[model samples]
Target chain A: MNGYAGKILRVNLTTGTFTKEPTPADVARDFIGGRGFGIYFLLKEVPKGADPLGPENKLIISSGPISGMMIPGGGKCDWTTKAPLTGGYAGASMGGHFTAEMRYAGLDSIILEGISPKPVYLFIDNDRIELRDASGLWGKATFEVEKQFKEKLGEEYQIATIGPGGENMVSYACINHDYGRQAGRGGVGAVMGSKKVKAIVLHGTKSIPVADMQAYRKAGMALYKACKDAEGLKEWIRYGTTTVVDWCNQVGALPTRNFSAGSFEGAEGIYGKTMREKIVITDKGCFGCPSPCGKYSRSKKYNSYVEGPEYETIGLMGSNLGIDDIEVVAQANLLCDDLGIDTISAGNSIGWAMECYQKGIFTKKDTDGLDLKFGNVEAIFTLIGKIARKEGFGVLLGEGVKRASKKIGQGTEKFAIHVKGMEQSAYATHNATAMLLAYMTCDVGAHHNRSWAITYDLQVGRDLVVPEKVARVIWLQNFRPMFDVIGGCRLQWVELSIDRDLYVPALEAITGIHRSWEDLEKVGDRIWNMTRMFWARENDGFGREWDLPPARFYEDAPTTGATKGQITKLEDVNRLLDMYYEQRGWDSNGLPTLETIENLGLEAVVA
Target chain B: MTASIRLSDSLKNLLGSEGLFTIEAGHSVREAIVSLGINPDLVAVVSVGDEMQSKDYLIQEGDTVRLLAVIGGG
Candidate 1:
C-alpha cells in the first residue's frame, strides 16, 4: 500500500452519507490504477441496462500509483461513468492539482452513487468529508463557481464544477477544473449533474507515501532533467499541442467546414505562431509538468481569457466551423469552459448543424432565425448558450450528432460525423486509413487520445489497408493509454519521444512493483478488453457496427483541399476492421473470442 | 540541384531561420536533411508539395520539402 492512499471513498448522495473501504490488493495488482480501476468498478458496480443518468449509475473517479508522486506529469485523474451520450463506457482523464489532493486525502477512488434530492457539493479536507448545500453555486458558470470556491475555501483546495450545461444535462457536458483543465468528454458532467452535485472541493496537507523514498526522489529528479534536456523542450513547452496546427493543415488531417474538406484556407490565421504573437499571455502547466502544453490567452476583441484553443479546438471550432480567427476561437474556448461542455463534441455537432443549414435540411425556422452559417460567430455563440441550456434547436444538438441525424432522417446522417454516437475529435480522417480505424474502435467512442495514428497513417501509406497498419493501431491502443492507467500524462513520452525506460525505475521505486512497458501494456490490453465487454454487456448487438466510422470518410471525398478526390473505399474500411479484429484476437463480428478472453486473463471478470 | 527545404518551428533552431533553406538536393529527403547536418530523428513528417512523403522519398528537381518535428500529443 506504499504508493496507494489505500482507501476507496463511497459517497451516497441519496442518503447524504459516506464510507471508506480499503482498496483491494488484488485489484491494484491486476488493474494497476487510474483507468484500470475505473473500468473495474464501472463493470462491477453499475449493472447492465442501467440508465446512464439515473440513480442506478455511478461515477467512479480514480488516481494511480504514480499519482501525487514527484514524477513528471503525474496529475491525471480518471473519471469513469456509463455514458449518457453513447450509453457505453465513458472515462475522462482530468489533469490538474486534483490527483495529488485525492491521494493526500487518503483515497484511490471516489464513487458517487445514488442521486441527491437537492443540489450539494462534496467537501474533503483530510479525514473530514461532508455534503454541503450548493444552492447558490448550482446554476453558476464553472469559472465563477471555481473562483467562489477558491475565495471561500482558500487557494489550497482544488475544485471540479459543472456549469449550466451540466445542470441542463447536455449529453456531452464536461466537468471543469483548475480554470481550464477538465474531465472533458463522454457526458461525465451530465452524470454529475444527474446526481444533483455541483462540485467536489478538496484540501489536503499530508505527504504521499512511496516504497523507496530515496530511489523515487532520485529517479523523479532524473526524469525531470531528462525532460528538460529533451531535444524539442523549448518548442514543446512553447507551442504544446498547438504546434501541430500547421502540420495537420499541411498534411490534410485538419477538419474543415464540417469535415467536407481536409485543409482550411484560413488555417494560417488560427495557427499556433499567430496565436502566440496575437494573444498568448503565459505558458501554463499541470502538476509537476516540465513541458507545459497549456497556453493561456486573453482575447482583446471578446475580452475573454482562456487556457487554450489547442489543436483540437483549432481544428473543430476554428477550421471545422470555418471560423478563422484565433481570438474568436479563444472566445469560443472560454465559452465552452464556462458553459461546461466538451468543445470537440460541441464543434462537431454545430458543424453538422451548419452543413444541414447549408443544404437546406434545416431552415431559418429550425435555426430560430439566426443564420446558421459556418463562419457566423454570433450564431456560434448563441448556439453554444442554447446547447448549454437545452433550448429550442440546441435540445436536438445536445443529444449529439448521431442521434440528431437519425431523428432528422433527411439523408443527413451520412454527414453527421461521429463514431458510435460520440463525435469524432479534430482529425479529419478521410484518406488516412489507420486514423480512420482508430476513431472507429477507440473504447470511449471517436476520441483520438487513445491512438493518434494520423502521422503513422501518413508515414506508412495513408490509403494502405495492410495488416501492418492494423497491427500498428492495435499496438498504439495498447501502449498509449497505459499512461492513463498508471495516472501520468503520455505527452512526455509521446511528444518528447522520451525514453520510456526512464519511468521503469521511478515506478518500481514508487509502488515497489516492477513493471516493464510490456507488462504495463498487457494491463492496458486487459483494460481495453474489459471496457469492450462492458459495452457488449450494456448494449444489445454491440459489435462490428459500433466500431464503424462515419460514412463521410468512406462515402464522400473532398472536392477541394489537400485530400481532393481521396476517400477510403467502404470495402477497404471493412478490410481494415477485419484485420484489426484479427490482430486483436476478436472474431469477424469484432467480438472477443473466448480464447482471446482467456488469453488476456479476462475470463473471470467477464463471466 | 537546389531544393526548397522548410523547417518546422522546433527545427528552426538548428537551421537558425524561419525562412526556407535552399539546400543542395540529395537523392532523398533524408539525405538532404543529413547533408544539412540536421538530425533525421528529429524530423517526423516529410512533405513534398501537398502530400506527406516518407523520409526516403526521392527528391525531384523542383521539390519543396517541408520538415515537421515529431512532437505530437493529444
Candidate 2:
C-alpha cells in the first residue's frame, strides 16, 4: 500500500483497449519498480530475438516507490524495450512530471503492446482511460504538439510525445517530456512510433499515500536542507553542466570537430560563464529536484525560449559537430527536442557524416549538394532535417552509426565511434580508461550516466591499468542505476554528494519497507543480472566480444587535443573486462553464472 | 581572517558587491553571512569549496567559500 500505486495500466494499441490490473505484490517485492519492473517484464514477456519494431516488442514505462514523494529529486521514470536501434535491451530513465504523475494516478507502470492500425494517443485522467485520434498531431514538433495538446486539454496534463524523427522511425529517436527532458537513447521513441502511438498523457488529483507521513516529511525537508546546504548549489545551478565546459575543454574532453580533437578552439563562447553572461535567463528543474540542472534560456540573439544546450547538447551538437556558437547549439538543442531524436547520437552521426564528406568519402553529390563539413552550423541544421526526413545521405545516417558504417564500409567504419550501436555520449574517452570502461559496460550502450568515472579517472591515474579501477566501474554500474529502479534521480547524491544514509528514513517511511543501501544494491545486482540474461538470450552467443568499446578508442587516437597521442591498448581492454567479469561473478564469456543469478533471485525471471 | 566568498548570479544583486569580498571567522557561515550584511535566512547551504559543509565550519584565512541560495524547483 505504501510506495506502490497498486495497479498497472496496460494499453494494447492493436486492439485500442486500455486495461488496469492490480500490480502483483510478488512482482513489486521482487522487481521493485521502474527499471526493475521494466527488465523483468522485458525478459519474461517480450520473448527472445523478437523484432524490436514488431507487435511482440512491448515498451514498458515505469516508476518506483520514491517517485512523486516529497523526497529531494525523487523523480525518474524508466523506458524499457528491445531497442530498435541496438537490437538489444534498452532502458532509459528520464526526468520531469511523468514519473510523479504515474505515482499520483495509482499506476505503477504503463505497458504499451502491439501496433495500432492507425496513429492514436493514450489519455488517462485518473480512472478515465481513452485512446484519441492522433491524425493531426502526427507531424508536429514535440514542443508544438505538447503545446497544442495543453491548449486543447488543460494545464493539469503532462504529455510525453515524439516528433517527426520518431514518426519516421529514426533509430535514435527519443521521447520528449516537459519540453526538454527525455527518455533519450536506443530508439525507445522509434518503438513507440512503430506501435503507432504518438503520445501518452496522464493527469490525476489523487493524493499519494505514505506509510509514515511524519517521517517522510521530516526526511524530505532534511534532503532539501542538505541540497540547500551544498556549496556548489548556487554556482552549479547558475551554469548547470555548462560549468564543466571550461574544465572539460581544459582537460581535453570537449569533443571538438567530430571528435578529431578533444579541445575546441572556440570553446570559450559556450563556457558556463559565457552562457550565463550571454543568454541563460533562468534556472529550471526536474520534478522535486531542488538543484535545478535545466538551464532554461532566452536567446536574445534568436529571440526564442530554449530549454538548454546542456553539456551533452553542447558537446555532441556543438563542439562534436564543430559548431561553436552557443546560440547555434541552443537552437540545435531545441530542434533535436522538437524533432524527437536523441541529440547526442544525432550530433555524433552528423559529425561522422561531416568527417566523411571532408575526407573525400562523400561529395556534394552524396550530401544533396550541401557541403556537409565540420563547423558548418547551417549545414548541420539542414542535415538534421534531412535525417528526420530520411532523404539522401540522411537515410544512411538515420539507420545509426553502426549500420551506416557497415553499409558505407570503405574505411568509414574506422571513424564510427559508437559502441553497441548507440552513439557515444558527451565525454570523449581517449585517455580515461575508467570512463572508457564505464561507457563500454553501460547497459544502454555508451551512455555515461550509469558510471561517470572521468572524475575518478582524473583523481586516480587516467590510464592506469588496475583492478581497482575496474572494480570501481562495476561498483558504480551497480550503485548509480539503483535510483532508476526506485524511480528517483541520483543527482541528489551524485552532484550534491549528500549523506546517502539520509534517504533511508525517507524511503522506509514512504514505502513502509525498510531497505538500506546494501538491500538496494542487492536489488540493483538482481536487475543487472536479469538484463544481462535478457541481452544474452536475445542475441546470438552474446559474449565479451559484444561488450567492447569503439574501435576509435583503441585502433585510433586523436591527432589533436590534450589526449592527442593516447589510446587504450587492446591488452588493457581485455584486462579490464577480465577483472570486471571476475568481480561481477560472471563466467569468462561475460554471462552471469547460474549461481550468481540464483543468489540475486533472477533465476525465476530468466528461466 | 580574509575569507573570500563568491556570489552566484542571483546572489550578485543581493550581495551589493560585483566581485569577491573578505570575511571573518569563529562564527557559523550563517552568522558570518549576516555579518557581511546579507540575509542569513536567505542563504541555503554552506559549501566550503567543492564539498558541502555544515554552517559550523571555520572560514580559514583566504578561504574562498560560497553561500548558495535555494531556487524554485519542480
Candidate 3:
C-alpha cells in the first residue's frame, strides 16, 4: 500500500523473540492506522477481562499513512493498551520523530506482548531488530535513558523510555520521548513496565512509498502552505498551548484548587506571558511541523530544563494545586516528565489529597508529617518523586485520584475530579455543559484531547443544556480524534484554524484513498463505537452512570471566580446525557443500540 | 470617547486587515464586530483586559478589547 511501511512488528518478551507480519489490507482499510489500528487490535487480540498490567494485555504502538510524510504536523503516534488506571481503552498520542522513525523502519504497528524474565529494550535499526539487555538502564529516568541511548548509538535513533513511575508501575505512568513529549495518560507505561521493557529505540533510513510522487509532493506543499499562511501561525508559535492560559482563566475554565473553583486568583504569575518572560528558552517542534507548540523552558529557580508547563499542566499543577509560580509549575513539569508520571493525573491526585487534608479528612500523620496544603511547592516536589517510586504516601497518590479517593473514603471522592477512573484534564467544566459532557463520555475517560468543546460552550451558552450543545460535543468527538487515527497533530487545524479540507488532497495523494470529512467522520464514529464497546466489554454494567461527571461540578458552586454562584443542576446533567445518547443513537443506558451498531457496520465486530 | 479593539489574526483575516482600531464607547462587542462587517458567530471570545466578557458587554472608554476566534480548545 502506498504511504504505508506495510509491516506489523510483534515482539514477545516472554520468549525474547520477534516476528514481522505483512500488514493486513482489510484492517488498514477499515481501521485506518494509529489509534484506529490500536483499538481494532486491542478488541481483536486482548482477551476479555485481561489484567491491564499483566502479560495478557498487549501494548500496540502504531502510526498512520500520513505519518513521516511531508505533511504538516505529521509526526505523531498512538500508544494504545488496556489502561492500568481505568482498565478500559487507552490510546495516548505522542508527538516527535518516533512515528516517522517507525514508518521508516517498515512498520505500521509494533505490538509488545507477554512479560520478560529480565529488563530489555527493543532495538530496531531498519530490520536488525533485537531485544537488547537493559538491566543497567532499568531504574534510570527517561531523559537519562534517552540521552544515554542517543549518546551511545547516535542522535538519529528515536527512543521512548519510562522512568521510576513506570518501573514502580504507577497507575498513570507515561512513556516519554524527545525529552518531554509523552504518551501521557492511562498507565500505558505501566503496561510496558509490567512487560519488563524499558525502551524502544529505532533508526530507519528508508523512504516511504507514495501512490503518485508528483501529486503527493504538490499536495504536501499545499498543505504546508495553508499552515504557513494561517493568520494565527505567529501567535501559535510564540505562546503554543500556553496561549490559552489567560483565556481559560478569563473565561473561568481554569481548574483551581482541585476544581473547587474555576478561576484562580493568582493566575497572573503562571500566565503564558509570564512563563515566556520568566523561563521559556526555545520553541521546539515535532517532525514536519509548521507552527511548533512545544515551549521548551529553563527554570532558573529550580535549574531545570523542561518542555512546557503546557496549558493542561499549568492548569492542573499550577492553579489546581494553588501554586501559581510559573517556575514552580515548570519544575513540577520537569519532575513528572523525568519521573514518567502523568502530570494531569498526578496533579489531580495531589489536589485531592490537599483537599482531604484541608477538610480535616487526613491528618499530617496520614501525609507522612508533610504539610499537605495547596501551594506547598516543596511538598509538591517531594510528592512527585514519591509517586514515581510509590514510596510511603506516594503509593496512594500513584494509584491516581479515583483509586486514591476510594481508598481514602471520606467524601474525598466527591472532589476526586475525575470521570470513569481517569482524572479530568485542565478544563474546569463547572457550568460548561458541552465540555462537561465531552469529559464524561470521552472513550479514555476524562481526557480532553477527544473533544475540546469549552470554547463552543462559550460560543453558544455556557449554561445551556440543549441538543445543539450535545450535537457539537458529538461532532467534535468524532472529528478531532481523526488526527490521532491519521498520525498527525490536530493543533495545526485547532490552534491555527486552518481549513481542514486542505489535508484531503494530501491524504488522497499519499494513500490513494479518497475521503472527505464526512467519510473520515464515519470512520471516527465507527472507532468511537468500537472503543465504547471495548469499555463495556471490559467492565460490567458500563453505561449512563459511568458517564456522569464528578459531584464537584454539579454540587459545589465556587464562592469565588467568574463561575461564582453558578452550578450545573444534577437534573440538567441527566438531561444533557439523555439528549446526548438520543443524538448518538444509543440506548438510555448509553450502550450503542443494535440499530446504531448495525449502522456503523460494527455488528459483527461488536458481537 | 472610544475603546481600543485588538483583533486576532483570525479576525484580521475575516475583516481584511486593520488588526487594531478604535470603536465607539457604549457599543456592545457584538455590535462592534457587526459594525466592522464581521459575523458575530466567527468571534468566539471577547475580553476586556484580562477578563473575558460576553459579547453583550458594553464597551467602556479606555477599555482595550481583545477579540479571538477559538474554534477549539485544549
List model 2 lDDT by residue over A474-503, tens digit each.
878777888888888887676555677888
- What candidate 2 gets wrong by more than 4 Å, as runs, is B1-74
TM-score of 2: 0.90
Write the number of the candidate with greater TM-score, choosing between 2 and 3.
3
* Each prediction's TM-score versus the true structure: 0.93, 0.90, 0.94
Best by lDDT: 3
Tens digit of per-residue lDDT, candidate 3, span A1-607: 8878999999999999998998899988988899999999999999999999899999999999999999998999999999999989999999999999999989999999999999999999998999999999999999999999999999999999999999889999999999999999999999999999999999898888888888889988988888887755766777788877776776789999999888899998998878888998999999999998999999888788999989899999999999979999999999999999999999999999999999999888988888999999999999999999999999999998888888888788899988889999999988899999999999999999899887677766789999989998899999999999988889888877677898888888888899999999999999999999999999998899899999999999998998998899999999999999999999999999999999999987878
- As for DockQ, the candidate ahead, 1 or 2, is 1
Please give the lDDT score for candidate 2. 0.82
Q: Could you tell me the lDDT of residue B74 within candidate 1? A: 90
Local error of candidate 3 at residue A593 (angstroms) = 1.1
Tens digit of lDDT per residue, candidate 1, span A105-132?
9899999999999999999999999999
Off by over 4 Å in 3: B1-67
- TM-score of candidate 3 restricted to chain B? 0.85
i-RMS for every candidate = 7.7, 12.5, 5.0
lDDT ranking from best candidate downward? 3, 1, 2
